[model samples]
Target chain A: MDKLQRNERIGILMKLLTDSPGKIFTLGNFTEIIGSAKSTISEDIDIIQDILDKFDLGMIVSIPGASGGIKFIPSISSEKADFITRNLCEELSQKERILPGGFVYMLDIIYNPVKIENIARIFTRQFYKKDVDYVITVETKGIPLAFATARFLNVPLIIVRHYNEATDGASVNINYVSGSKKKLQTMVLSLKSLKRNSKLLFIDDFMKGGGTAKGIMELAKEFECEVSGIGVLIKTAEPDRKLVDNYFSILTLDTVDEENGIINIRSSR
Target chain B: MDKLQRNERIGILMKLLTDSPGKIFTLGNFTEIIGSAKSTISEDIDIIQDILDKFDLGMIVSIPGASGGIKFIPSISSEKADFITRNLCEELSQKERILPGGFVYMLDIIYNPVKIENIARIFTRQFYKKDVDYVITVETKGIPLAFATARFLNVPLIIVRHYNEATDGASVNINYVSGSKKKLQTMVLSLKSLKRNSKLLFIDDFMKGGGTAKGIMELAKEFECEVSGIGVLIKTAEPDRKLVDNYFSILTLDTVDEENGIINIRSSR
Candidate 1:
């Protein structure tokens, strides 16, 4: 087998420590991988840390005492985030995403890496700009975008369920008229969970009637928290009453007519 | 207003380049911001380019003889991502989430930065370990996880769509049974796309019934790529079939009953 070099060691070390949560490493065990001296490994570790710093991807924390080597935190800065959002907005514009009821069929473009990273970065930047403390979304579709935004901002995300369960006690519920359903329904955050005056960003997969977003707004107000902003994967070009104050989208489905073979899309970062 | 600090100046410089795309800037603008000398600004730009590599975010591209001040490419890499995953798994286990119907509410916690960062790191590490060339996911919910995974791996992502459109000329489609629909649904992917023999890690928001996963698996095979592994934000304790080959999950849902206020969560990440 070819002997592992410093660059290889750095790559392996990143692969190993990145998925970890704390700042502790087993140095004795770590140096065994490349079979290199601890001093040599230490120098490699330094250079590796420099590379990580360049990317704005947190840092490598070394533990000094025995049973310690290195760890990682989740971090990123704005300048280092160009490729991500730029790619997302760019690819999203390429889709012929047209569906009925102002819905967009953007499954293809949204999945691309460059776009996803950028979407996450842009949404997070907006959320942070608003100083949102947390992220909120309804079940199923909104989950992915919410997760990405939350990861970028390093904030907690809340998922609201339509139905009530015994496990989640004493919920605050609200209802309003919404798509087909006679009444809109939503559950409030568990009291004392997110603290009063907390700011949150509402995320959804697609926005049409705005009923779900309205319901989330009601839930946020019930918690005595503020709705910092809203974001979505796609928004219909046709205008509708927006429920939240501020929002952005990756793609706008200008129109989609299955029979006419007409689908229009434009990017919105 | 106070003058922008040197670090902030660098950030602003990156922003200008990112927003303008193919544009150049001269030292005069730098002088206006920090009141620094042209040479100082030049050195600052040099330091930025040298220190922050990969961020392909573009470069100083000094044109010695003419038409250039600076240009950027916009890129970044994953380096110090080792210590976040395990911590995320551990924090995820602590959520104590249990809801009926075997649904674990870790999605909320997974969105939480307290552990979400770790989860993202761990996921990225897995991507590198598997040497995945790309990250794959379905739309709506999977976008965020896919984005995070892609961000960590610094790879491209490809999203699969539920339905086909005329815009996607000459495509390949596959049918997989769905748990919610209880019927086979056709998912589409572009043909001759996704470099053949590319390594991919499939990620989703949640997994149950194994049908959706199997469908994703088939989608990858359609592209002539090898499935490196499978990952999910949450997984049902057990399902009738296993959709993934090698899977990793932050939390497992054991039971969920809407009426009994009963939910059980199991963790073995």
Candidate 2:
């Protein structure tokens, strides 16, 4: 095969990395694609890594050893993350956005591909080095964010459904009490969704009392999987006692003044 | 800002294009990002486009006009698409996948981020030039695919729920008959999900009878919106008369031989 020019090689490398985020490509892989010497490919990767770092887009990690390979980890700089959090807080703070039961109208932000993609970058960076086998989330609102995170992680996304559906087939349904409302809720997952002992990362659109997260943990346990980490877009500040601890959130909703049409939201930092 | 070298410019351009596929970026935007002249940026874009073409990855579309800009439309080559469709067909053809009813156990594929991402690129390319305001899908299995398609299109994904939930908060509900069973079905969408007369593209994991797609159209009608197009991963061949006509599907499931565990599937050529 003929070697690609420097510019073209860099272009293809970026495309390959961006196409399959969190996937590691061995030196042989790059050499085969670019038809260049290992040393030349290594230099090109270093240049690409440097440019990515300088732009605050993402970083490439090269593992040493014959069995090691270079991996691309998507990330947003602190400044960018903060900006996104602040913007999201503002967008979600509108009085009209507050639902009757204190839930915010976050469908717009959660479903917005551009916003979710940036947020996914931030979340993926958190578990980039973790041994996460799958990204899990409950049905409805959390699906998009979870899918985004899974895409960046290059892993399969497992969704837990709220109601029994014929399509799921042989699902494991578990009932749990909602932490905030103390109401019974049932979450179901297909028996074939995940392999046993998989390390799963749970992500959601919102964390009220961590009831859903706890339920997810329980569900993972039922499958003999472990919940490696929990991430949420927003966690209510009033929930001083959460069912699950050690979770990460982008923003904290302090107060919602429905009367005055005001909401006090702060970035988690 | 200092001008970026050719290699660096190409790398950054690929990242930008990959980050927000199907979205247009003005030449001025690229020039600013690369800190170079518009001509240089244009040349760089041309080179990237050529490389993408040579690799059969996707295409760079340049719209000419005062309001025009360059758009990155992600696509899978026909060979790749056919391969994906064939693999998915085989995966879905298992007798175990065929539920008591005709529904197939599709949670795995729909939730699989990598597969959905590739399928999404195909769906997004189909409507890249259309004025699509939102990518709509029903809850459960279709959310991930809808989200993927929306992500590629850089649009908001609007999910229609099969059952009413408190979280949706005052949604627009519609009733439609399931095309296969002729049973009544209800689908609800948040009233705030879309604006009046917004153009929507509906996508789903499976299209048994196109009933859900038809329901989506009815729900969109309540908001005075129009469904520009509909795309599905699998459409059963038995349903000669579809509830919604003129929809694109990647694969058509011809027959499910339960006795021998054989599924006759064909790619939509």
Candidate 3:
């Protein structure tokens, strides 16, 4: 391949780094691809970092040592996170979202790729420091958010399901009570999903009683893995206390006035 | 913000356009963000496009008209797609993945964020021209791949579940025969998940009898939507005839010889 210009090299670098967040790329690797000197590549990385800082996109972190290399971290600035959460609260507060039995219709936001990407960025910023080996979530609504978070963190995702299938092979099952409903439910995970001593980050779309989070913790223990971090998009305020104490939530749902058609939700911050 | 240099502007543009795939951005929008003239921004976009093409990252499409701008289309070149699919087949055919009952354990691959991103890029290249309004899939293994495809296509995802929940409000349920197992199963989707007369793309991790795809087609009909496309990571070769005639698959699973501990798989291309 011919040598690439400075702008072209920068463009390719930015695309490759951001596309696989947290994956390390040595300077030598870039030098080989772009045919540039180590010093020139280092200067290019500094410029990319400056541009990232100026735009509030993300940060480029350099690991020091023999195996060290630079990687992209999907961290959102606090101001930008605040703005995103506020917009989300506004969108969720719309009266039209209030559904029967006081349930706020959130499938639209939770399943939306663009919105989920932003939400997962916030979660990544919160849990990226945990050095999570895997991002785990219960099947259904939480899958999208958890998948996006796993992508941003450059880790594998594990989905625990309500039931086991033949395709899953041997599995481990645990039962836990729903936090709010107080209903018993079972969680299933494939035995081969995680490695022993792995650290997991539990991500979900909603947390009403934190039952699912607790269930995930119990399930993780069965595999000798640890739940290092927990993050959710929304949590209810009425519970006051949850099954698990340490968790990060983007929004707090104060109440859903079914009769009056009002949804009182706010940013957790 | 201070004015950005040409390379800096190109970096930002590449990051923004690729991050939110298929999202249109007007020249004025770029000018306001980068503090550059419209003509200069145009030139930056041209450079970014060339870089993207040279690297086979993706393409920058120009949409010209009122209420139109430029969008990034996540298209993988055929050579790259072939290389990825072949690598996938080699990894999947490992003897360690052969499980009991002739089932190949694939949760690790399907749930892997990096692998899913590459697989979804291939799917996006196939279906992006369909102008799909939504990407839908059934619960369990397919969620991650479907979510990634939806992200690349910049569309909302609709997950059809096996059971109903109150949080989904009123859902439309349909029963279909499992093509391989020949057992009847139900699929439920929220009534409000899709707008009427929308184009839908069904994505999954594996296809046996294509019963799930058929079920999805039936469910789409209930919502007055059309199943414009179907894509899966792997399909069984035994069923030379699938329930669904038109679908794209990345790999063909010829046989999993449980007795002899041999697996035969090949790239669909």
Candidate 4:
């Protein structure tokens, strides 16, 4: 490959760093790829960091040591996060989202790639400090949100299904009661999913009674793992006390009045 | 925002365009955001496009005439795709991945964020020309892959579940036979999931008889939609004739010899 100009180097560096958040890259690595000196690459990184900071995109953290290197951390300013959450609350509170059973139909919002990415950025900011090894979630509605969170955190995702599949081989299953419904439900995870003593972050679309979060904690015990962090898109207001105490939620749902076509929701912040 | 420099403008433009693939952005929009002249923004875009071409990251497409603007399309070089597929084949054929019942454990690979991004890039290259409205998949293993593909294509993701939830409101349920197992299975999707007369792309982790793909086609018909493209990460060699005639696959699984601990797999290309 030929030598790259400063602008080209900045573009390439920005793309590479942002694409693989949390992955370390030594100065030598970039020097070899771009055919530049270590000093020049270091200067390029500073410029990229400045751009990232100015745009509120993310930050570049430089580690100091023999094996130390720089990595990208996905984050957003508090003001930006608040703005996004407010917009989400407005979109979700629309009367048309109410269904027959007082449920706010949120498939469009949760399954949307762009919106999920924004939401995941907030979750990543909340949980990145935990040094989570994996992002786990129950199947169905929470998969996309959890997947996006995992991507932002640069961790492997583990999905616990309601049932087992032949392709998963030997698995561990646990039963837990739903927090609000008090109904028994089985959570199945492949035995090979997690390493022993690993830390997990549980992400979900909704949390009514925190039953699912507690269930994940219990399931984590079976693998000799721990649920260090929990984040959800929405939580109910009536459940003043939840099964688990420590959690981050983007929005709070006060009520959904099917009769009046009213949805009372607000940002958690 | 202050007046940006050439390198900073390039970095910002690259990040914004790549982050939201397929979303149109007018030069006036960039001028307002970067506080630059329209002509300056146009020149910056040309430089960015040149850098993208040199790096094989992707291309910045220009759209002319009224109501037209430039958009980013996620793609990778054919050589890079081939290299990634070959590496995957090597890793998957390792004897350790072979499990009981001749099943290969692939949760780690499918759930991995970086690997899924690379694989999704290949899928985007394959199906982006279809102008797909949504990327659809069944629950469980395929969610992450489908989500990544939807992100790259800048479309909403629709997950068809095996059971119904009240949060989804009214749904349409259909029963189909599993391709390899020949057992009847049900797929449920919310009635409001897809728009009428929309084009859909089906993506999955694995395919044996392509029954799931075929079922997606059936489900599309009920919604007055059409399945415009199908892409899978891996397909079996035994089923020379699949239920679907047209589809794209990245790898082919020939056989897994349980006794000898030998697995045969190769890139589809």
Candidate 5:
């Protein structure tokens, strides 16, 4: 049997670790794939680890048990996070982003995979320690962010739909009052989407009066799950009184000038 | 400046290429970051390319001329894709997935990032040559798959919403008949989502009568954009006739036994 070159082993190792950010691959598995000794694989990982650390990309965590291997934890440095946040703030503050009724047109950012990937990294850094079973979000807009966050956390994403449908399979629907609009709304979730006694982290693109967040909490109750935390990309300053507490927001929408078509925003650093 | 070791250079290069799957990075940029010469970076890429080829992973394409350097194209081998598709089919065939009215409950697959990533890879590989400006999908279930495909294609994802909201700016709304339910449904997209003469690929989770796909075509016409392709994860076989043609589907739902909770399915391959 031929031995794998150092460059080849490192290249494949890098691909495996990066493809699934939070998944753990055993050293034995790497050795088998590369047809190398465990010691050689460990040395290769050291080099890979050094490169990741120097570039502030992420880290390779080694579990120290018989069944343990290596896991890649995706991360961005504080400097990079700050730069991304400020850039997003500037983008969101553009004059044209101010839609009618003080709503901001920021779907461009929400669905931009590159931008959302970075934002999800930041959100994961905040809640990675929570041992969450699933990442939850209310449909339609927040799906991407929540999906990205769940990808980083290596958890399943549970979506709460606004309307009940026969396709959802025995959903639990609840009526809640919208905090901002003060109108009755229905939120639905399939009973099979979540498991009982699970921990959930709720993420959304925008938060106003936290009415939806509050509704999510109520829905989780129906499934016997706990809402551990809430994260929003942009939280409005109006209706300063929020329906839910204990949430993290990256940016705050201070005000929107409808007549002048201007938006006032600030980062939550 | 000290030259970066081969292992370190390969590690970081792999990370850079894999992190943003389809994004291009210049040789000059790599040299500047690693403090290495162009010749050395080229050699490193050769080694990385060889490794990728050996493992049946994605490949690195070197573009010529002044504007190109290198781009990472993500892919999965035919064997792997078939395995994933079969696994997904088995999962979907479970009796619990059959809801009332013969609808299959597939929200779980839509929200599972790991699965969606693989599925997106399949879709992107199909339409990678189309030079699409945007990957479009109707909101809610299809967002994750669209976002994943857009990420791989290195394009923006445009979500068509069911209800127009103030946050969408000026949206173009059109009502279409539900091909299956025979009901009138409204679908919307922000007028600003696409540019004139742009190309788009429409993707969705399930296709019944292809009414939504047809609506997407009409909406794109409003923006003066062209629908280049359509991809759906699952298509119902009962709709002997579809509203759109030249579409790709991974799985076909032949029939559903709602009483026995059984689903008849087949692989498109």
Candidate 6:
């Protein structure tokens, strides 16, 4: 058999690890695929390990048991996280995203990758530090951030929709007093989505009257799920009937001056 | 330097080539990481080259000279694409996620790694078959699929939202008739999120009214960005207006039998 180069060897290993997120590979698989000795593969792993460490892309964890081969750890450094957060704030705090009367357009905050990646990483870092089982958010604006957080943590994301439908048999519906619009509205979530006593991290785009957030919280309670953390891309900071605690934000909006063509964005924290 | 495993070395090399996306790496860099002689590393590359071909993930193109190391095709196979489509169908068809209103709760379909990873692979394989600078979707439900797809394609994901706000400027706004309610609603997206003429793959959770989808299509046109492809998890198959041409759906629901609690789903299609 022809010999293999070091660079070529590392490339193959990364693919195997990424393709199977949680699966541990065995040395035998490599031998069969590459037709190389186990010793040669071990040396290749060391080379791949160093390169991964240098780039801060991910980690190659090796298990000693019969079932263990290697797994890649998805990680984000503080520097990268900060870079993403700053970009997100700068980009989302623009004039075009502002709504007709006063609301800010927030979909941009969750969409941009350069920004979302950071939010996802930071949220993941914070979530890992806490005891969160999964990330949860209410649709249709909160999905991006929730998805990112879930991806980073390697956990599932559950969403609560606006109305209760006959399709999902048993759902917990919550009616919250909309402090802003001052009306009662419904929020529904599948009972199976939220596990009992499971830790959850909540995320959304904006917080105004906090009614929706509050409603989602109530939905969590209905499932007996624990709210571990709350993170938002922006907040109105209305200071009344606050929906969440233990939250973080990329930016805060103090006020929106439509007539003056001025919008205030809170300092990044 | 210590010797390394051949397969491990190949993994490291592939990452380096992928780090720069299209850029090729030099043999020197590969040699340095593996700490193996150039000849040994070159031999390892040969084995990896074939493995890549076998897995149908991509190809390792070797470049000769001082500046040349190796390059990855960053391509996917048709088999992977079909696998993804099948997985998406299965995920969306799960019995537990069926909503009472004849809607399939899609939160789980996009959030599950096993499902998201497959969906991502398919997007990269079939739609973004050429160049996709970004994965685009509307807030707030489509975010999960978009994020995963973008992550796999190594591109950014952009979210379009309703209501133009100040935070997202340099954006294009368009009005469209919504499918769910048959009301005209405005959608906004950041111009800066997408580049001119760049290819974008649009994804969404469900297509009932296609109003939001139409609005998104208009927004893409306004931005002068190319709509490379369109995809959805569920297509309701509305009678009159068709919002997207190129798309895929896991399940197609024909009608909702509200009285008998029966839903006619297009499982085979």
- Identify the leading candidate in terms of DockQ: 3
Model 3 bad stretches (over 4 Å):
none
Model 2 lDDT, full chain set: 0.85
Share of reference contacts found in each model: 0.27, 0.84, 0.88, 0.81, 0.86, 0.60
Candidate 4 segments exceeding 4 Å error: none
Cα lDDT listed for each candidate: 0.59, 0.85, 0.92, 0.92, 0.88, 0.67
- Model 3 CAPRI quality: high
Q: Tell me which residue pairs clash in candidate 5.
A: none
Ranking by DockQ: 3, 4, 5, 2, 6, 1
lDDT string, candidate 2, B108-152, tens digits: 778888888888878876777786989999877888888888878
What tens digits encode model 1's per-residue C-alpha lDDT throughout A1-269?
35554444554455445433333566666666557777877776676565556546546656566655666544456555455545544544443544444344454444444444456655654555465777888764566567666655556767676666443445676765554334645554444246688998888777766667777777778888888788887776666545454667756667666666655655654
lDDT of 5 by residue, B1-269 (tens): 46778988888898899888778789899888898889899999998888887887777877788888898888767787788889999999999788777788888888899999989988877888787999999977888999999999899999998898887888899999878878998988888878899999999999999999998998888889999999999999978799999999999999999887789888887
Candidate 4 residues A1-269, lDDT tens each? 87888988898898888888888899999887778999999999999999988989988988799999999988899988999999999999999889888989999999999999999999988988898999999997899999989988889999999999888889999999999999999999999999999999999999999999999999999999999999999999987999999999999999988888899999988
lDDT per residue for candidate 3 within A14-66, as digits (tens), equals: 99899989999999999888888988888889989998998899999888999
Q: Judged by lDDT against the true structure, how good is candidate 3? A: 0.92
Model 5, position A156, has a per-residue lDDT of 92
Q: What local lDDT does model 5 show for residue A265?
A: 91
What C-alpha lDDT, on a 0 to 100 scale, does residue B167 get in candidate 2? Answer: 65
* Docking level of model 6: acceptable
State which candidate, 5 or 6, has the greater TM-score: 5
Name the TM-score of candidate 4: 0.99
Q: Write the per-residue lDDT of candidate 4 for residues B107-196, one digit (tens) a residue.
A: 999999999999999998888888899999998799999999999988999999989988888999999998888989999999989999
Which scores greater on TM-score, model 2 or model 3? 3
Which scores greater on TM-score, model 1 or model 2? 2
Per-residue lDDT of model 2, residues A169-208, tens digit only:
7889999988888999999988888999899999998888
